[model samples]
Target: MKAADFASASPSAIRAMIGRGEWTGPTPGMAKGHVQANLVILPRDWAYDFLVFAQRNPKPCPILDITEPGDSEPSIVAPGADLRIDLPRYRIWRDGELVEEPTEITSHWRDDLVGFLLGCSFSFEGALLEASVPVRHIECGCNVPMYRTDIACRPAGRLSGPMVVSMRPIPASLVTRAVLATGRFPAVHGAPVHIGDPALIGIEDIARPDFGDAVPINEGDVPVFWACGVTPQAALMASRPPFAITHAPGHMFICDPKDSDYAVF
Candidate 1:
C-alpha cells in the first residue's frame, strides 16, 4: 500500500496490513486520530511488579490496557485486535538482551505471558499538529529521536533504570502551546518532562540519539523532551529478565480508542 494509503487507513485495516507483513515500518503517521500504544509482554510471574512500577512511574509508563495472562487480545483497548501480529515489528528480549527483532511473535507467544499496553506519545502528536506545533520527526519523515536520561525511575521489583525520553524541537514561540496541547492527554505521556539543554538530562549529543532517528533542530527551536514508553525496554535490559517482548522503537499497536477519548479537558 502507498504511504498515503496507510496514513488514511482504519486502525483495523492498518493492523491487517501488519498481520500479513504488507507493512513492517514505524507506525508514527498511520491511523491518525486513533490512540496508538506501546506493547510490553512479560511472564505472568513478573506482571504484578511491572504493574506497580508503572503506577509509580506514570510519566513514562502510563498504563492503557492490560491483557489476561496468555490472552493475545487487548479487550479493553481494541476488543478484537490481536497483539501478536498487529504491530509492524517487535523486540524479543532474553536475559535482558534483545535477541531478535521480528514481525510476528505467534511462534514465541507463551501461555504464561501477560501483555501490557502503555499510552504512546503518537496518540498526542495529533493534538500537537492540530495546535500548529510542529512535530519535527514526522515532518522529516523519520522516527522521533529518543535518548536515555540520567533521571532514574523508582524501582519496582526487578524493573529499575534511567528514564528514556523522546525529543522534538519546537519553535521557542510555540513551546507553551505545545505543552498545553499535549498536556490534555495525560494517558499518552501528558506534557513535557524537560524543556531545554539536552546536556541537563545527560544527553551530551542531541544529534546522536540512543534510539530512533535524529531530526534537525532548526534555528529558533527549543529541544522539548517527554518521558518515553521505551523506558521499560531499557529497564528490562538492565534487570535482564529471562524473556520479554516489546514493540520495536517507533513501531506501535493502534487501538480503537480515539485520541480525544484520552483527553482530560
Candidate 2:
C-alpha cells in the first residue's frame, strides 16, 4: 500500500498490517486520528520501579496503557491487540544491553513480563495537521527524527536516564500554533521543550540523528523538540535492566483511542 494511504486508515487496519509483518516502518502518519504509543516491557519484579519513573517524568513518559504481568493484550487501549506482534519493530535488551531489533517478540515472550504503553508524540500530529502546522517527516514520508538530550530525568528506583526528544521543523510562523495545538493533549507529549538550536539540547548535529531518519529543515523552518516516549529506552540503556523490551524509535504501537480521547479541548 502507498504510504499516503496510512493517514486515512483505521487503527485496526494499521495494526493488522503490523501484526502480519506487511507494514514495518515508522508509524508517524498511520491511522491519523488514533493514538500511537511507545512500548516498554519489563519483568513483574521491575514493573513498579518503571511505573514510578513514568510518574516522575510525565512529559516524556506519560502513561497511556499498561498490561498486567504475563498479559500480552493491552485491554484498556486496544482490546484483543497483541503487544508481542502488533508494533512494527521492537528493541530487546538483556542485562541493559541492546541485544536485538525484532519484528515480533513472541519467541522472547515471558509470563512475568509487564507491558507499559507510553503516549507518543504521533498522537498529537493529527491535531497539528488539523491546525495547519506542518509535520515535516510525515510530509516527506519518513520516520520522525529523535535524539537524546543532556536533560536528566528524575531517578526512580532502577530507572533513570536523559530525556529523548522528537524534532519537527515548523514554519517559524506557525510555531505558536503548533505548540498551542499540541499543548492541549498532555496525555501524549504536549508542547515543545526546545525551539531553536539543537546544540542547546546536546544535539551537535541535526543532520545526524541518534534515532529515526532525518528530514530536511526547509528555509524559514525552526527545529522544535518535544519530549519523547522513547525516553524509557534511554533509561533502560543507562540502568541496564536485566530484561526489557521497547518499541524501535519512530515505530509506535497503534492504540484504539482517538486523538480527541486524550485532547483537552
Candidate 3:
C-alpha cells in the first residue's frame, strides 16, 4: 500500500495487515499519524546492558515502549497483540550475525527474553510532511540514506559505538523550519544534529550511504542528518552477542499512540 494510504489507516488495521502476512516490507507510509517503533528483542541476560545503552544514547535510542522478560505482548504499545507475529518481518541474530529473516518467531521465543520499542524517524518525518517541509527520500521513493558517523555515543556496557544518522536533503530555506518542527517531538529521534557539510561529520561520500538507498540531492538542497534508531542494531551486530532480534531496516512496529502524543513545547 502507498504511504498516503497509511495516513488514514488505524494502528490496528496496519497491525492486522502485518499479522496476516500480507505486508512484509518497510512501513514508511503505513499507519500514518501513529507512532511507529524500532524493535530490539534480547535475552534477559543482556537486557540490563542494552537498557543502559539506550539510556546513554537517548537521541538515537529513545525508549517508546519496553516489555518484560519472556513477554511477547507489548501491553503498553499494542494491547492484545503479540510482538513476535505483529510485525511484518523480523531479523534474527546469533553471535552478532544476521542469520534469518522470519515472518514469525514462535519457535525462537525464549522464556528469558525482553523486548524494547524505540522511537523511529518516521514519526518526525510525518511531522515534517505535515508542516510542508519536504523529505526528499520519500518524494523520490527511495530508502532514506543513512551513514555511520565519527560521532561516538556514550558507552554503556556492551552497546558503545559510533552514531548512525539518516540524511534528508532539505532545501536551504526550509532547514530552520524543519528543525523547529521536529524539535517538538523529542520522543522520536528528534531534530537534526548537523545541517551541512557531510565532510564535517566524517561522511566522505554522501551518495554512497553505509545503509539504506541513496536519494537525489537537488541543486539547492543541503544535507540534514538526524540520529538514527538503527544505531543500536549496528552496535549489537558489532558486539556479537549470543542472540538478538530487531525489525528489519525499514520494517517497524506501528504503535497505538498518535504522533501528537509525543509533541512537546
Judged by TM-score, which candidate is best? 3
Please provide, for model 3 over 72-179, each residue's C-alpha lDDT reduced to its tens digit, 9 standing for 90 to 100: 989988897788888888999999989999987888999998999999988899889988999988788778899999999888887789999999999999999999
Q: What ordering of candidates by TM-score runs from best to worst?
A: 3, 1, 2
Q: Candidate 2: misplaced stretches above 4 Å?
A: 13-26
Q: Write the per-residue lDDT of candidate 2 for residues 1-265, one digit (tens) a residue.
A: 6555788888888888899999888777678788888899999999999999999999998998889889999999999999999999999998988899999999999999999998877678888988989889978878789998998988999888899999999999999999999999989889888899999989989998888899999999999999987787678668877899999877889899998999888
TM-score of each: 0.93, 0.88, 0.95
Worst 10 residues of 2 by lDDT: 1-10
The lDDT for every candidate, in the order shown, is 0.90, 0.88, 0.89
Q: Whose TM-score is higher: candidate 1's or candidate 2's?
A: 1
Candidate 3 to truth, TM = 0.95
Q: Give the runs in model 3 whose Cα sits over 4 Å from its true position.
A: 1-7
Q: What's model 1's TM-score?
A: 0.93
lDDT of 1: 0.90
User: What is the Å distance of residue 69 in model 3 from its true position?
Assistant: 0.4
Residue-level lDDT of model 1, residues 1-265, one tens digit each, is 5545577789888888788998998787688788888899999998998999899999999999999999999999888889999998999998888899999999999999999999988877889999999899988887889999999999998789999999999999999999999999888899999999999989999999999898999999999999998887678678877999999877899998899999999
The residue pairs found clashing in candidate 3 are: none
Q: What TM-score does structure 2 among the candidates reach?
A: 0.88
Q: Candidate 1 — which residues are off by over 4 angstroms?
A: none
In the order shown, what is each candidate's alpha-carbon RMSD? 1.7, 2.4, 1.5
